[model samples]
Target: MSTANTSNNTDSAIGAPVSATLPTLSRQDRDDSRPQQYPSPSSPHATSATSPPIPTPSPRNGRAGYQLSLPIPRLQRSEWVNLEGLVECALSSLGKDECTGISELGRGSHNSLYEIRFSDGTSCAASISNSPRQFFSADAKRSEIATMQYIHSSKLYKIPIPKIYSWDLTFDNKVGAPYILRECVKGKNLSEDGRFYRLNARDKQKVVKELAHVQAELSKPSEFTQLGYIYRQEGENGQFYVGKMATVPSGSDEEDKMRESFMGPYDSLTELWEARIERETLCAIGNWSQLPSDASLPSMLPPAKANPQQFGELQQLLSGLTNLFTPPEQLSKLCIHHSDLAIRNVLFDEKTLKITGVIDWEFASVMPLVITGRFPNDLGWEGNEFARSLGKFGNVSDGGVWNHHYYDWTSLSGVQPPPRADMPSPPASPTHSPASIDYLTTPNATANGYLFEHQASVLEDFDNSEGRAPSPPSPPLPPPPTSETSQQDLTSRATNLVELYYYRKFYASKLAARNFNLTRLFIDAVAYIKFNEIVLGGPEKWFASADWIKEVYWRMQEEDESAREDLMEGKGVVKVPEVFLAVRRREVDLGKWENKVMSMR
Candidate 1:
């Protein structure tokens, strides 16, 4: 929909335990013109060739919002939406006389939003997906619509979720691009007001309490029937698929292969996790099976310092983790998580600190508590002691303090959670509230006989380690002596290993994308080992140390570039551009700093 889209960077990888961020609402320059009649739906007309020019927002403003209406410079290849066509389509669909004002609402990596006010003073938001290269897919748009519809139908949460009036998945709908029209939820976004950090402790706590209660409501297990994307099936008799894995078109022949199966709406959380683990394992071993005959590691590798014994130990540990978390019995319970609860997505009134709405449900999914238990990464603040002290500013779910607020609110609001079928009856303790017990403990604790206290400790340690922040906690790597580990040990180790694997995989993917040749590093044993070692340090440490790895890669990159230059010079080829030559010299300097890091290590 044409709702605000936050541009904050957030983790939204499938099956990854990362937080999400959406687009932010940018302040708009008020249009001086009076309200105009809404375009008639019966005889819609797009702006003429000489239609009065739409005023573009000035760039002098510090905040650019999501999409800058200013035409991107010629060399910039970023996708741009056909806003004129979208405006015409939206106005036509609404059947309003003519829009009084249509202004850029926000922009995000994948979509751009515009607010359209009808002559009658009513308005709606329009979200147009960036064509040719969309961050989100057709299935994702469908799932988002389904999520909002489902949430609206349930009336489970007190905060407002915008209602989706209509949507066009493909440009075939005369809009020339995919767009969603929904009710324009009024009230300034928290980011726009820049008032989040200004609230009093009492108000901040109130926001946290409200957030926790909303989380509790969203996480109801009974509401979702299965694990996967939600959508409505085709045909007149098509049924709504709440928990079905969605499939979408892929590859060059998008139309013919439209029926092709994509990944899945996994049957269980274990199945989804295994699919990811298996995919990454392939990047390491290539096509070689784990047969004794193929005992040697692949040869497409560079020499490294990793010991074979340690490599084998880690590999075994990772494998044990895959098997350990594979079974349903050992898995945690599943529930829907917003997945992207960053500040941009949260809407609230600064006066009361009461949240008015939470937007962008596109990434919402049914995931395990292990994935959804922590606060969003974007919400983490390590250096700012003042921000950390406020329950709303720092991680709300930290230390179970937010959980207490959530429980208290649930009790006061009379929002009863459906009984967890898996939880065991606690020893008679009148003091322990069921909500408190439920919030603190996990399904794994109940199923595996792990103590509630132990579950809390592990989850907290885990959030501290893998979660993003200025200086995340060092990975609480399981105590030494990797031999003779138990199931619980494997579980603990597996969680970290999974987190580490994804962490390295994310960077590795980035390197490959930036320097296509670096993809060869995946086969380079030395590179692979160093990459894992980096992530093994946990999020903060790994991120801090990443410059070293990038330096080595870039040095090798510059060397290759220099060799290319020499070949061209020897062949009497054209001289290289001074700009290119200067860039190479700077790269060489960067390599020196990277070398320093290695020397110290």
Candidate 2:
């Protein structure tokens, strides 16, 4: 092979203009698109704003741009939420006298949620999601925090609301995401309340009116506050839209065929702010794992065992849900609404059929306001579950099986979100943002809506839901391929490992060579390697244990210089310093997520 190692389009960050790609949960189905990092030529101050001398424009648009992705920040904003004196303060602020005192229940996924009991023993639930790092900047994060702060400060009036006890700066640190605390109100998610459908027409009308009222609250701009992403004013009238983003992601083989502009750095926090209203002005766009299989689809469907009428009803629901993804003219509009609106993400009271608290508001971006589907239509099946849980930063919503909402809980606090239309036409140019989204003008057709009731605060009836279904039985998929596909998969996996190692070494070299600070470089270096591990199916899996990583140091060797020369020749392998051998042997968190889940749960 030639000695020349081709850098190809190795320029990191979103090179050239890239298209959007979905990061679907299922590994195979993830977005092949890339993130766009640099500004376009049209912007007045585009040249002066960015740093690192914006790398070369991508040679093309569709390539993974993994070669062109920007360096993952060593400084990823830590999701920090810490609260001091939140429970007492929240109770005092609500100023209600139902019982004697409140004790802390365990937390849900996002905020450290708590249930406050009154003197007479009535209870309410509250959640507070706040953190340091980019909460100082992330528009969506700020949006959630600010919106809750607004409602809490005003005692969340009008609808049955969770009294936001307070949103104060408790403290900050590297480990824990900082947080604010609020009371858990008495309510249940409408989706879970089967009793809701049993309500008389008059009761249903009252519910509809309450729902309308919630939407009305969201319609006005004041109830919503700035999410804090930077939006720059662009175009004829100098309209402001979403500008720079704080959580701008770096490209990864984690991406596929197309380039994704998901990650990058913010030019300024103001840019993050300006990004809110501004249309996609220029700079644009932009986690994990596991699986279990299930039975034949026939059994999975309700019709398999049901009579004709039941089968027809099931078919309609399936068709309606399926139809959500059909292409349309207008894309979902983005505005300030409850980000965590999943069926599982709510609280309620049984008797009155009221909504108590809306929890989990994490991935709350001002994107197309898709109203119909309870879950994100863009995400595949696996992603839908994740979106319900991990997407929001506000409330905690796990699958319905382990839920406590079935009791007499009512979620009175409601929301007003505009319905989603088809994917909007591409931006007039290469810019698009939430404000640019146009769902208001497009007519949306009515689809089936969910009917349910308030939750009663009784002990969980989990036994019914839990043991009802047997463990999923797997079916044989297509037979394994000849050695060919398997080899390709292995080769691809190995190549990824090599490339991961190469990039880490390359990045370290870049940092040291440029005289970047060791602190920043150190953080970036570790993270870069971790990102690579994700591609290599992870290091912990490969190494098996941390002890192995330590034990294997300097022991693994290339059998010959020819192998070394090959890895180096075409792939910049020749330049790799010997120190990387040592780097690979270093031990770090092997099963952070598993450990975290077990301990935290």
lDDT of 2 at 458: 15
Candidate of highest lDDT: 1
Cα lDDT tens digits, model 1, 80-170, are 4555344455555665544444554454334556555444445566667643432235766787777776676665544467666666777
Task: Identify the leading candidate in terms of TM-score.
Answer: 1
User: Could you give candidate 2's per-residue lDDT for residues 81-199 as a string of tens digits?
Assistant: 32223323333434432222222332212233333333322334333332223222234334344444444444333444333333333343211443343433334444322333346
- Worst-scoring 10-residue span by lDDT in model 2: 1-10
- Model 2 lDDT on a 0 to 1 scale: 0.27
Cα distance off (Å), candidate 1, residue 590: 35
Clashes per candidate (backbone, < 3 Å): 21, 120
> What are the candidates' C-alpha RMSDs?
23.3, 30.1
